[model samples]
Target chain A: MTNLSAELRQYLIITASYWTFTLTDGALRMLVLLYFHQLGYEPLQIALLFIFYEFFGVVTNLVGGWLGARQA
Target chain B: MNIGLALQVVALGMLMLPSSALTVAWVMAAQGLSGIAKDLNKMSAKSAIKFLVTDNAQGTLFRWVALLTGSKNALKGAGFFLGGTLLVLVGFRTAMVVMAAALAIVWLINLIALQSDLGKSASKPKFRQVFSKSSAINRLSLCRLFLFASRDVWFVIALPVYLAATLGWEFSKVGGFMAIWIIGYGAVQAIAPYLTGLRAGRVPDGRDAMLWALPLAAAPALIAYTLNSQFEAELILVGGLLLFGFLFAINSSLHSYLIVSYADRDGASLDVGFYYMANAMGRLIGTLLSGWLYQVWGLQACLWISALFIVVTAALSISLPRSGSTLPTTQ
Candidate 1:
């Protein structure tokens, strides 16, 4: 790891972080799906739980990129 | 990145509260936080890649983007399996506590490992610039929006519920099947460049995107037709799902590569972010339709909607520039 360039090392770190995030994200989705179904929620009701999640994702991407770009 | 990780921990913590306290609205709120965290981390990670790779190294860029996207998806599949197994083994609240604790540890490590200046750009981009100005980007974003919407329409709420309710599969079976499908999808995505002639020094363009969509659009349609004809529902669905996962992975990988290639090198996050915003919007619409359509009509309706969206995606792909988004760095 020490012999690799700075960029390669940085990429690895980012990838590792992203991997952990994705893992949790996927698991959470399944947990919600099965748990709520077990609780007898309607399909639409289950979908509603994710509405805000997807909605905020739209907002975050639009603004987050600009913030990332402006960072010095 | 740290903020995103911290938010995820908090989201999990919210779920860890006692069952009586876990109201629907509360879970939604927690999910909202997780959503924000996921996109922030994703946008930053993707944009950061532009900084690591030279402008001329587009082949390397494609490989890196595919690997990251593919591996992330594969990990997501593992997460699904973990979620299912944990629920059966320890129950929901316990699983939440375990995940939150684990993610908190990962967060602390990333806090120290990530450099402060990772995605800092030479020029500061303004808020208004967040909306992309490039026609190529705009077209690709449109395709991406519909493409993702098509998948989520069937995959999100409809498929799992259908598998469990109608087919009488166990939670573990449903979750396991979904996990294997996604893991296989990710594997295909990782190898998409090789399948599409990257080995022969051919870099994909808008034409490739269009070509891939044509077959994907047909897959769900065929499934829907077979199911309507009183064929074995379980067999048809499983077969359709495998076909859909394979074709969709290639189309998705191509788009991932194109977006990174087309993004402005100076502040690549701007374009990548806008593109994913459309992607999120697609998921939003598809998720909503998945629930409503499945409740009112059935899984077939969701499959039809998916097919329609893919057709729209193919149409939109036509408007993207036929010329490659970036110069191919021959490996």
Candidate 2:
């Protein structure tokens, strides 16, 4: 495990982390949408619950990556 | 040092907590956080590629980016199915908890192993720098915006509801079809480079995009016409959608490679970030229009509008550089 180059190790970590996050994000969305539908929430209401999801995603891409940048 | 991992872990926990306390506002707020988490993770991961791969290896870059984008999309398909299965097996809150715990472990490994300073530019980029200065990037971003809108405007609201309400197909059938379509689309995207002629050491050029997107513009228009012409509505629409999906996947995968190829080496995330912002805006606009247009004019109208958007996308693709051109000069 320790034999790989540092760069290779970092790459693995990033890909693994991204994949893990994707699984949860996908599962969680389905969980919410289906669960709420079963609980009698209106379709419009279900859609509304995700209103900020895409919006926030755009905002994060534009700002958060910059904000996290260290003075290299 | 990886801000993306933190956001993702927090998002999972938030999902777990919100299920038991199901106020509408709370759920929406959690979704907002999840959205932010997603983009952060996406930006971080993609930008990491630039640092990992050498710049001179354009072929490697294309392959790697295609692999990453393709696999992520395929996983997203799995995630969708997993979401439903978890809900059925463990209920919502428990499902969230289990996912959260699993992601936390992944996050932990990332923290312990990943070296800091990856994807950081040599200088601190001003907040405004998120808006890319590259004319090529700007143009490509515009094309991407419309391309995605063309898909979601019809696919999001018009298609599923139309199939369910109008065609009398079962809900599960509709979902299964869409899921299969998405997974297939992802698979195509992974192999798009080969399909679009990435072999023999040539990368996709603007002309290739133009040639690829040429037929795409006519597809929906033809489908909409066929829908009115009395051919089996389900057959025409479904078959048209499948064709559209394949073409769109190719165009989209090419664009993804182009963006990474065009971005500046230092802090490539800025360019990537700006591009995806346009993408998200397009989706938002398309989603709104999908519902409205379908309501006011019917699904045919939505398809027509989608055709119209693809026309503009095709036009934009033409102005892109010839195969040998290095810069994305505006035509």
Candidate 3:
């Protein structure tokens, strides 16, 4: 019972932290777009930049998923 | 026909529109962050189960936590809608700046909030081992890959051009349609858990739920093409939008249940990397192909192609093994 309580506390802490990160990460992404636009990239250029971003994400997601599965 | 694959195809197709770089970045970043969040969730569940094995009380607590996590999808959807609308009104550059700053703050808070135990550790198993032991994982990956390769190419690249040429919508209006479609999709997700429970008895199982929802999913796009009047077209499109929401809600829950359960039963976790890999590859193919399709064929042809893709995915959904319940496996 005591151990269960301890685990719950840990889980709650972790969840809270993760959610905070999730929210901020979302906000930062918005900021990146603004930075790129301010640099004088046209709409088409911006679209291409996004394609690059998605391309990078594809790589990272695979790596992250692989890492997560292994850790579990 | 996996819902995730379908959504990825849709997202890739969205990139083809004349949206700003900021919007695309936001979408891609969201995808990456979601990948990380999913992995963390699976690990949390595994640890929670371990605690339960040692002490039952902890197991129940973990279950509640898991439920809480599942429910967060709705809140996230609302946030996306609010954020996206706000960005549209504020100008793309301003929105990007605000969102980026928010991301930095989130990162810092996450670091502070979670103890070291929540962080990724070196002691975790090597990546290869995660897939090495599971034949099912490999099979599922192949299935996802095949589905993505076949469907996404036409939808992402070809469909937008088709809509533009045939329907005479500007890029922003195209984006508006996409936004509405996504919002419809998210709305379904918000209510899916409850909806599933309500219809649980009527449907034989979760697999059946997916099968029934399959055809209805394509109704919106199919109808939108038939109407020539602008208002009529919009009405049909909205209907499709609603159907899209409904179908996605049902299909997503089923899809999640299958993948999560398979992982738990096998004492494995769905490799978030592999899952996203399949997704990204599908999108890459889908987007490129869609672009080609638009060049070669007319917009009407592209809509037909998108419809065909939906039909194929729906049929594939019917063939998946029938899981006992739509409830996500927490551990």
Candidate 4:
């Protein structure tokens, strides 16, 4: 790790974090959908469960750039 | 970025509460947190890439972007499978505990190891700059919104329910099928450069975007057409979906590369974040329509809507500047 350039190290870290995050994100969605279905929630009800999940995504991406820039 | 990871852990924990406490509102709130966390992590990682590659390395850029985007998607598919299996095996609460704990460890490691100075700009961009000023970027963003919308419109709710309800597939089988499709799509995206003529030393442009979108636009309509003709529904759907997934993978990979390519060298996150915002908006729209259209008009209607969105995507792609062409600076 010490021998690698700073740039390479940073890139590796970013990739690792992103990969872990994605796995958990995907898993969480499946867990919720399947679990709710088992609870006898209607199909439309199950779909509605993800509405906020997708809606907040819109908001995050909208403002997240400005937040990133402020940190930059 | 560390914050994003930590928030995910917290969101997972929220889902671990007793069953009686887990109402629809509670789950939606947790999901909202998870959504915000995921996008923050995504925006940070994507923006960071612009700093890693040197200028004038278009091929390298395309490869790296494709690799990152592709692998992330593959992992996401794996996650879907993991989620299903865990639900059946350890049950939901235990699964939540396991995922939350694992993510916390990742967050801690990232907090310690990541350098703070990466991606910082000399000048702080104003809030308004978050809305990109470049016409090229704006056009790409609009195209992206519809491109993603086209996929999610059919893929999210319509396709899965159709498989379960109409086709009579088991829950695990449906989950597995979706996992395989997404993983295969990711595999194609990783190698999209080769498929799109990167081997011949040519990178894609807006013209290429339009050309690729044309075939993709036909796929859902074709599926709708064949199904209407009373052909074997199962074969038509499986075959048509595979074709759709393949073309859509290439289109998505191309868009991912082009955004990084078009982003300004400095504060690339501004544009990347803005582009993904549209992507998120598309997903929101598509998910809403998927629910509404499937309920009212069935899967056929959803497919028609998906086709319509793709046509709009292709039309938007026409105005995209060719590679190396001077783009209009202002929106």
Winning model by TM-score: 1
lDDT of 1 at B116: 79
Better of 1 and 3 by lDDT: 1
- lDDT tens readout by residue for model 2, B114-197: 666663323335465645766667777888889888987787666755775678765445555666678889878767878877
Candidate 4 residue runs with Cα over 4 Å from true position: A1-17, A65-72, B43-69, B108-125, B130-136, B198-205, B256-274, B319-331
lDDT of 1 at B236: 85
- What does the i-RMS of model 4 come to? 3.4
- The models' CA-based lDDT, in order, is 0.83, 0.72, 0.48, 0.80
Q: After superposition, how far is residue A29 of candidate 4 from its true place, in Å?
A: 1.1
Alpha-carbon deviation at B73 in model 1, angstroms: 1.2
Best by DockQ: 1
The iRMS of the candidates, in order, is 3.1, 4.0, 7.2, 3.4
lDDT by residue (tens digit), candidate 3, B5-57: 22232333333333554354655554444444444443454443344335456
Task: Compose the digit string of candidate 1's lDDT tens values, residues B153-191.
Answer: 999999999998989887778888889998999889878
What TM-score is obtained for chain B in each of the predicted models?
Answer: 0.81, 0.71, 0.56, 0.79
- Whichever of 1 and 3 has more TM-score, that candidate is 1
Residue A21, model 3: Cα distance from true site in angstroms: 4.5
